[model samples]
Target: MGERLIVIEHEAEAGLGCFAGRLEAAGVEAEVVRPYKGEPVPGRAPAGLLVLGGAAAAWDDEGYGWLPATRDLIARAVDEGVPTLGICLGAQLMTMACGGTVERGDAGLEIGLGEIEPLPEAAADPLLSALPSGPVRAIQYHYDAMTTLPEGAVRLATGARYANQAYRLGDRAWAVQFHPEATPEIFASWTGGGDLPPERAGELNAQVEAAGDELRRTWGKFAEAFAAQLTRR
Candidate 1:
C-alpha cells in the first residue's frame, strides 16, 4: 500500500489541525482535497481515507454540490474495506451513506470540551481502545447528530447530549461525532465567527485550552492508531 492517505477537507478553517501533526509524526502522508475550493474529490483511496468536519450539514447537497460525491466516496471506501475515519460532518455523511439518519440535534448545539463515555464495545475496538481507560474528553462543535447508526455499525462511545458519539461501521470504517482533529487555536477560529454568543464562545475556548494536554494525549493516540492501520494495509 502507498504511504498516502486521502483527506477530504471541507473548508479552510476546518482543515486538519492537530491531527495533521500526529499523522506526520506517525510517518503517514496526507493528501488534502478541498472540494469547496474547486478541487475534485477522488473516487478511491490508495491507502486510507479521512473525511474531516465542516460547517455544512450532511444533507446540504444542494448548498454544497460536492457533498454527493463525498458521500459516494465514503460508501465506496467502506464497501472496499479501506481504512476510513470520519469526523463530525464526515460522520454524519457516513451515516447517511450507509442507510442511517442524521438530524439537527434536539438538545441543541453541542459545542465545547465534552466527555465521551466509551461503551463496553469500545474495549475491543481497534481505534477507540487507544484512548486511555476511564472518561475521555474531546472537542465538540456540531449542531447535527447521528441519531441512528448504519446497519451493522458497532457503537463505540456515547455522550450525554448525543448517544451516537462514536461508532465503527464494517471492519475498517470508523466515525466520531466530535472533532478530535481540532486544536484550541482552530477551535477559537471557529467560534470567532459569532456562531455562539461572545461570552459563551470565550468560555468554551478557555475550557478547550485548559484541557489541551489531555486532548493531545487522547486524540493523538487515536490518530496514531489510525496511522498504524494505514501501515498494516
Candidate 2:
C-alpha cells in the first residue's frame, strides 16, 4: 500500500528534522503537520506516525485549541495499528488516550541532555530490540511527565525523573518520552526568537548535538526493528 509516516508537530519550525531523514533512509516517506496552527490530521493512510515534542503539554492542548480532534485521530491511528512514536507532549497525549495519567512533575525540568535506561521489555519489542541496551543520550525539555502507563503498555526506557520514558503497545505502536530524532537544525528552530541568552544557547546546542550522536549510534537498530515490524506477519 506504499506506506508513509505522518509527523504531528506542534510548531512548523520544530518538526521532525533528523527523524524525517532517518525514516527516508528506511524507505518511508515522511510528512509533517503542525496541529497547533490548525493543521489537518490525516486519516489511516500513513505507514506510521511520529508525533513530535513541543513546548505545549497534554493538558495545554486545549489552550492551543487544536489538540482534541488531533489527539483523537492519533488514538484512532494507533488502535488501527499504525506504528507510532510519540515524543514529549505527544508521548503524554498517547498516555492520556490509552487511559494513563499526565501530571506536572514536581521533580523539576528535564532540561538539556539526559540519560534513558532501556527496560528489558524494550529489548524484546521490535521497536527497541536492536536499540541501545541502557542509558542512551536524549534531549530533554519538559516539566510534565506521564505518571501512569496506558493499558497493556510496556515501559521501554526510563530515567531518574520519569520512570516511563518510553513505552510500547504491541509490536507496532511505540512512544518515546524524549527526542531521539532531534537535530541541530530543528534545535535551532525551536530556539528561534527566544531571549534565553547566548550561554544557554551554547549549552542547549551541545545537548542537541549529544542527542543527535545518540541517535546516530542507535537509530538504525530502531529503524530496522520498526521496518521489520511493518513487514511482519
**Relative to the true structure, how large is the alpha-carbon lDDT of every model?**
0.93, 0.72
Model 2, residue 49: distance off in Å is: 1.8
Candidate 1 clashing pairs, residues 3+ apart or interchain: none
TM-score of 2: 0.87
What value of lDDT does candidate 1 attain over all alpha carbons? Answer: 0.93
Per-residue alpha-carbon lDDT of model 2 for 130-197, expressed as tens digits?
Answer: 77566677667778989988889888888987788888876567878877666666666655557467
The 10 consecutive residues of candidate 2 with the worst lDDT sum are 224-233
Off by over 4 Å in 1: none
TM-score of each: 0.98, 0.87
Number of clashes in model 2? 1
Clashing pairs in 2: 4-47
RMSD of each: 1.1, 2.4
Residue range 1-233, candidate 1, lDDT tens digits? 23799999999999888888889988889999999989999989868999999999999999999999999999999999999999999999999999999999999989889999999999999999999998799999999989988999999999999899999998899999999999999999999997689999899999999999889889999999999999887
Q: Where in model 2 is the C-alpha error above 4 Å?
A: 43-46, 191-197, 210-212, 231-233
